[model samples]
Target: MRKHQSAGSAHGLPFSPPRHSQCGCAPARTERCGGLRRSTEPPPSSRARSLRRPQTVDAPSAPGGGRTGGRLKAVAVALAVLASVLAGPVEGADWQAAVKLNAGFTTMSGITHRGTLGTGERIGIDIDGEIERHRTEDVTAGVGASLGRRFGPWLLEAEYVWRYRTDWDATAPTPTIQAITNVFTNVRTSTLMLNAGRTGPFSARWLWEAGLGAGAVWNRMRSDYIERAVSGVRPERRFKRADTKTSLAWNLFAGISRAVGQRWRLGLRYRYIDLGELRAGPFEARPARLFANQGAHELQLALTLK
Candidate 1:
């Protein structure tokens, strides 16, 4: 028999074929055997191993976290309460209360006298060209308070006011036929009124107001007469008379105001008032009567709270 060439030499291959593992699988194809494939990659370097290790990063802290967050919340709540307290009620509130102080310049239309003076029935007498009159111009001060409700841009209020006393002096001729006589009168007046009004805004910080009022006025008058004998026919006579009267009164007013602060305002107003009639004697039969009608210009400062 011919000598059998070695298998490798017979194939004329450069190298011998590799043998299979005992498991019957080639090393490079071991995954086909049904188990996980072994990695053929080279072992990792030191730096690579460090990068692959599980990382533990620290998280960033919040600006005001933990106890600091609690303190911040408390501070925010305190600021809110302070703002409310300092500002008072907001603009949308419907109810308000106010107080005002006023100074006024008043002009009075002179009194009108009616009914004839009888002989010796003379109440105070005057005989200056058959004309009798009493008039006054004065400066007066007053105070007022009000409660109001708002509807849209309109505000309606009910107010009460007290005006201090005012005084006037007048001179007239007496009607006594026997002697040339002169009468001097002193008058004082005080007033109390209740008013209702509506106020509306005209500009960003300005408002207009109008009102009607009804109330009472008290008037006190004192008269002194001096008589001179004309032709020395009658002895000079001097006499005095005093009277007090309470009368029904009414008024109308209009004003414009500018806000001074959150709760205060400054205003200027004009008013027309009528204080009924004043009688020298009782109502049924009076020797004389005086009509008191007046006009006033006022400066007012007010405070309102809601």
Candidate 2:
């Protein structure tokens, strides 16, 4: 038995037919099964929808899978960058509890006055030693320590500045000795100070402090005491007089500092000193007074401990 499928536009494309029979025998030619009938065409809307619709395909799954894989890749990159940064050194970084050292030049400035050597204003000596005015400037150096913690924009530090000053000079017109006394000398002075300061981006660091400072000064004078030259044969005897005394000193200070590195700073300060009075035994039988106004200045270098 044979079957025929005469396809036409009546049912559109892709339409086919197959005849089926259970028995092995075919029906007679006169027996017709539903021949040419009314044209069955889908509506214009349905046809247009079928044309507009796209074929669907299932997407392939990646081996590593979904958004989780992309996220992991991003995380890995970030970690690599972080590791590189950690392997490198950073400047001006904070370090807690570290030992440090520093040394630099310094200078001391003030008005040095030479006081009287004798009690009498008028005597056989034309004039008792006058309080002569002179200026002292020299090279100095010191070493100190400090500890700090950063708080926002403020750097809070507790510091102990142990500074030393050398090269003290003085000259006075003396009546105790008939000749002009050419005085040349040196002094070593020390101070312990506490400072609190701030560093700005454009301006230098500023530090203001108030603390007690004590110093030991040694003064060397050229002239010796005059003895009553009674008989030229008698030797010059010792006089019961002094030119030196252990004195008490005090000061108030304001300063500015420059940070040379993470652990070092160089500072310059201006202070008003009230050293009160000092006494030297031999050349000065009386009290020798020292006074300094705003003209007093000090330069120091410091090491950061933490």
Candidate 3:
């Protein structure tokens, strides 16, 4: 029988045992040498392992991720702070609501009129005249409500007030005509304001406070003018107009208060408010416009439930 030969020997190639690395690891395959070798360096210490940062795989991102999420979180934090501020006072402080009755006087200034005076075309007559400036004063009264929060001696409030209708009148002789020009104006006003102020001890029984406020005022004015004949030569001409205007308003106020009960307080406040301007149209026939700068000094008796 023929002698059996190994494949490598038959091919005239030498076959050797698998080689080992200097670190005592074996080669994994015929072509690769010592690829599975253990590291020659010593093992990492526990402290070193603890200090190494953890490796993390990247995760798929959602729509509007990263920056958007950060912005949303910031906004949420801001709104929470604002809500807490507006909802009430700081810890161990008071939140109050008040109903107030105000009685005061309003002064009218810069009252003037301009444009033509007469029934144009139909009466076949028109006259121009320089009317004298007029100023008037009237009594005013109003009712109001306020909601506020008190932080120590500081207070913040939102208030709404409505004043009843008041009338003003002025008459002057027309320079160019034998007529007395009379202007009658009826005014009604309402305001909404935000106020900030401080209160401190005045006496054992009374507390003193002062504040400033700014807001919008809605003024409704109804106005009419009459040119009555001082001499019978000219006929009486009457014109009517009505208008509403919104303007910026502001006030300064000071007050004194006394505690009525555990949850009640009675106060008297004086406020000086700029009511902006009163304006009325250029009426038909008379074709004249009216303007007045208006302001008020108000004394208010407020009953508050704290």
Superposed model 1: Cα runs more than 4 Å off: 1-110, 118-129, 132-158, 164-170, 175-183, 225-242, 281-306
Clashing pairs in 3: none
lDDT of each: 0.58, 0.39, 0.75
Q: Model 3 off-target regions past 4 Å?
A: 1-85, 88-90, 114-128, 175-177, 230-232
Candidate 2 lDDT for residue 123 = 47
Candidate 2 TM-score versus the reference: 0.38
For residues 11-49, write the lDDT of model 2, one tens digit per residue.
Answer: 676644433466333222232448744334466687567
lDDT of 3: 0.75
Ranking by lDDT: 3, 1, 2
TM-score of each: 0.50, 0.38, 0.65
Lowest-sum lDDT 10-residue window in model 2: 214-223
lDDT of 2 at 228: 32
Between candidates 2 and 3, the one scoring higher on lDDT is 3
Task: Give the Cα-based TM-score of candidate 3 against the true structure.
Answer: 0.65
